[model samples]
Target: MVNIALGASLSTVILTVPVMEAISLYTGQPFIMAMTSVQTVMVTITLIVAAINLNDGQTNAIEGMTHFVLFATFVMLTVLGL
Candidate 1:
């Protein structure tokens, strides 16, 4: 409810961190993020872009396009399986 009170829309994405940690513990396999993968690279870039773009509490077409391009590239890489 803190997110609701704060009017923050980022809670959904933030919640996944703990949920994933709990899932890893429950499964006992311990999820590990491979640092040398395409997804990792995309995720890192996305986070950096998001931090820079969203830092001022506003968004624009350029910011949206950046994310779309990153997603498209990630999808293309996934389809090629490399």
Candidate 2:
């Protein structure tokens, strides 16, 4: 599962960025290939938290709750930030 997640993320970055940039350029729009500081920090924190939680390669109620809380935080941040 972890390998699949990593592969999908890697492929998305490898494949999407260039295609997005090309389309942006073709459309005469600036391709802002960057995330906001909040987004970057949040993503970094999420990855760190996920790594810590998944280190034992097991999931439980606590893990699920933590993930749900994190996801809720993400949605709130996105909605409120905009």
Candidate 3:
């Protein structure tokens, strides 16, 4: 799980930075602002989930459901341009 999380996060950063930079270049927006906003949100959510799951050291069914739902929502939002 840790490996999976690490890989996913690394890929996100690798992909998002360039994409954000491209968007900024084309739109004349600040790249740093866009990158920072995305980084902050991702970090905040990761910290919150880590905190919530730290005590038990085990993921319950509800937690699994939450993760799945969140992932699905992310995919849909990305696809739909939310």
Candidate 4:
């Protein structure tokens, strides 16, 4: 699950760069730096979450809900551009 999540998260950045680049070409506004910063922040947050969760070696229903909420929020925010 962790691997899957990591792969998906990484792919977002991979897939976004080309699209962003194309938009920048058409719009004459460079956004690669903003995209890069967003990716860096995402990676840092994911790493922190993984480190904290793995160190505990335990998970409960609330943790499961938290994970779900986090992923859902990420998806919604991405879709809504929030």
Question: Each model's RMSD to truth, in Å?
Answer: 5.1, 4.5, 6.6, 6.7
Q: Give the range where candidate 4 is weakest over 10 consecutive residues by summed lDDT.
A: 34-43
TM-score, every prediction: 0.65, 0.61, 0.45, 0.45
Q: What is the lDDT of candidate 4?
A: 0.72
User: Tens digit of lDDT per residue, candidate 3, span 1-82?
Assistant: 9999989988888998789889989999875553344445655775687678666788888887766766676566557655
Candidate of highest TM-score: 1
* Candidate 3, residue 58: how far the Cα is off, in Å: 1.9
**In what order do the candidates fall by lDDT, top score first?**
2, 1, 4, 3
Q: What are the Cα lDDT values of the candidates?
A: 0.82, 0.86, 0.71, 0.72
The CA lDDT at 45 in model 1 is 89
Better candidate number, 1 or 3, judged by lDDT: 1
Provide backbone clash counts, one per model: 0, 0, 0, 0
The per-residue C-alpha lDDT of model 1 at residue 12 equals: 51
**For candidate 4, lDDT tens digit of each residue in 1-82?**
9999989978887897788888989999866464445546665776677677768898778767766766776666667765
List ranges where model 3 is wrong by over 4 Å: 1-43
In candidate 2, how many Å is residue 70 off? 1.0
The CA lDDT at 49 in model 4 is: 75
Candidate 3 has a TM-score of 0.45
- Give the top-scoring candidate (lDDT): 2
Which candidate, 2 or 3, would have the higher TM-score against the true structure? 2
